[model samples]
Target: MGARNKLKELRLPKRSEIERFVKQRPTCGMEMLSFLNCLKANQFQDSACVRERMALEECVREHQSSTGSGSGRKRKDTLMYHLKRLYYLQRR
Candidate 1:
């Protein structure tokens, strides 16, 4: 059984059951993903990508947190990914 199924089988308390959730519904998420991608694509070749990615990252984080997902079901850090690229570029 999956982890959630196992949790259910154990008859855990409501707070202890560990419900899984996402920042946004599938359609909303797809829309946001596409929009973010568009923002990152065809940048100015310098700070544009990083700057836009950071803004997108903050929006995603704020949306997810406002949904009460908290630390759970949070998506991967795309902002960090952009920051890493910027760091490498600066280092070169």
Candidate 2:
């Protein structure tokens, strides 16, 4: 009712605004792929792929710190970020 109407009235970001925040390739893509490959090669035995898993974790941490995403906020490149933002806006 009223809440739905208010939500519908809220202005959404333009396509260009969202596009700039979108990442063509995820951060640490290579490290992630390497980890997945190792897991597959090891027959999905996590114990046998500790090194690859560690490498991927390190890559993700480095990327998060470099991009200032270590603060626990959702990355703007993710759809979840926009959705949550919109939800909050509607609540306000």
Candidate 3:
């Protein structure tokens, strides 16, 4: 009965629970696309896209600062983190 209770407590997390931790798109995604498009339109000339590049860089910097040095879910609860924790617990 004690072992059975332990097994019940060790049940795997639901698929939806894990899926909810999926990483979101970057805040600067639009800026990145704009920069890429600018480069492509100008025959891949870096000089032609300098303004777009600057805008993209600024967006990235702003995002990084807002997100505490760009850790971006590194220390947050994520799907892989959940799985690894369960794996180790089950192993023991």
TM-score of each: 0.30, 0.51, 0.52
Model 3 RMSD, rounded to 1 decimal: 7.1
User: Positional deviation of 72 in candidate 1, in angstroms?
Assistant: 3.8
What lDDT tens digits, residue by residue, belong to model 3 across residues 1-92? 68756865786766677676565776888999999999889999999998999999999887777667676543354667777777676666
Q: lDDT score, residue 63, model 2? A: 81
Compared to the true structure, candidate 2 yields what TM-score? 0.51
Q: Name the candidate that leads on lDDT.
A: 2
Candidate 2 backbone collisions, by pair: none
CA deviation > 4 Å runs, candidate 2: 1-24, 72-92
Q: Could you tell me how far off, in angstroms, the CA of residue 78 lies in candidate 2 after the best superposition?
A: 19
* Candidate 3 ranges with C-alpha deviation above 4 Å: 1-23, 70-92
Q: Give the per-residue Cα lDDT of candidate 3 at 72.
A: 50
Query: Per-residue lDDT tens digits of candidate 2, residues 1-92?
Result: 89878797887676677677764787788888988998899899989989988998998888888777778675444686777778677767
What is the C-alpha lDDT profile of model 1 across 21-61, one tens digit per residue? 22335534654565567655755353545655666667777
Name the lDDT value of residue 47 in candidate 3.
Answer: 97
